[model samples]
Target: MIIPAIDLIKGEVVRLHQGKFNLKRKYLYEPLFYIQKCLKEGAKKIHIVDLDGAKNPNKKQINLLKEISKYQIPSIQIGGGIRSQKDIDLIFDLIPNAQIILGSSIIKDFKNVQKWFNLYNPHSIILALDIKFNKNYEKIIFINGWQNKSNMIFEDIIEKFLNIGLKYVLCTDISRDGTFLGPNINLYTEIVKKYPEIFFQASGGISTLQDILNLKNSGVKNIIIGRAFLEKKFTIKEANLCWQKE
Candidate 1:
């Protein structure tokens, strides 16, 4: 599935390079316009991240999210600064069909996150692990909007959650995010092979139809596209063709 991603900053659509706020590029259209375009082009699911909320949990763009919830067509997956039960309740209240994405909170409060898995359908909660490689080529998880690094290893954390009913994981290569360099194919391929039960959503650096095809060929079922779609690198329809082709 080619999931069109829209990162929001105070209700405007924007893309941040390598997860850096200062290096973001704002688009001309608002969130709804892009959502409409993606739907028109046959996107079944849409990924939305609240940058404002990611930076400060209290600063979530509630009005914008409310506007998005009005369109009850696409399966919406929303993330960023969604740390507690209150946040989860608010999102479900506004967009009942939305899949809540949990990031930093999962790492900081692993035990509490387990309660969420028991409370909500496992499929409705996506665990987002943003990663960066170390000098020795170790995949380390970065949290807090990619500004801070944690001591957690990518595979180890996933291993811990798998037994606890983690169904979906959105892993982003922070180094490749918004860079348009290319995806971390080797990493995703290895992870998919290691854990075939989990539905993995590959994000970051997907700039071309070939990238989508490569990810699909690598056994990655879901791909999150941000800058590529916003910059017109390829249309959702074209990417879907590449993904759906046998």
Candidate 2:
């Protein structure tokens, strides 16, 4: 599954190098451009992150959600600034057909995560496992867009979501996110091997057609691309071939 990214800031798809707030690069494509491209590329879903809301909690998320709702994409997994139940409600209200991704909020308050899931159920929820490698190079979950550490074990969080009837997970290697270097396959491969029960969506630094092939052969359920697609490192047509091979 090839899931294209639409990282939004003030209502446009922008790529952030290494997830750095100051290093944002806006794409020439309008939000609609990415939607049409991903759909034509045989993408069943699209990953849209609200960057502005993630950095500044007070920032509004309606415009981004509105734009997504207008698109005819099958499923849209959206995240960033999704802290309160009200925030989740607002998103669902705008895009009732969308699947919401809860990131930092899950780490900070699992109960709140549960509350939303309890109300909305599996179809509406997905946990985004945003990870940053520590000094030891061991992957550690980060919240608030890599600003704080959750110090949680990888499967521990995955298991929690799984037990609560949430079956989808969108994991990212923040260290590799938007770098266009390469994905952290060793890390993803291990997760897919260990947890065959949950659906895994791999994100971060998937720069080439080969990288997509590697992920598919390794059993990754889905792949999310950012910098590589923005930088023209690979074309959507090429990415569709990788997914077709799977």
lDDT agreement with native, every candidate: 0.91, 0.81
Clashing pairs in 1: none
**Residue-level lDDT tens digits of model 1 in 119-207:** 98888999998999999888899988888899999888898889878889999999999999999999899999999998999999988
Instruction: List TM-scores for all candidates, in order.
Output: 0.98, 0.92
Model 1: number of backbone collisions: 0
Native-referenced Cα lDDT, model 1: 0.91
lDDT, model 2, position 91: 82
Over 3-122, each residue of candidate 2 has an lDDT whose tens digit, in order, gives 888888888789887778788788887887878887886778788888877876789567667866877778888888888888888888877777888888888888878877778868
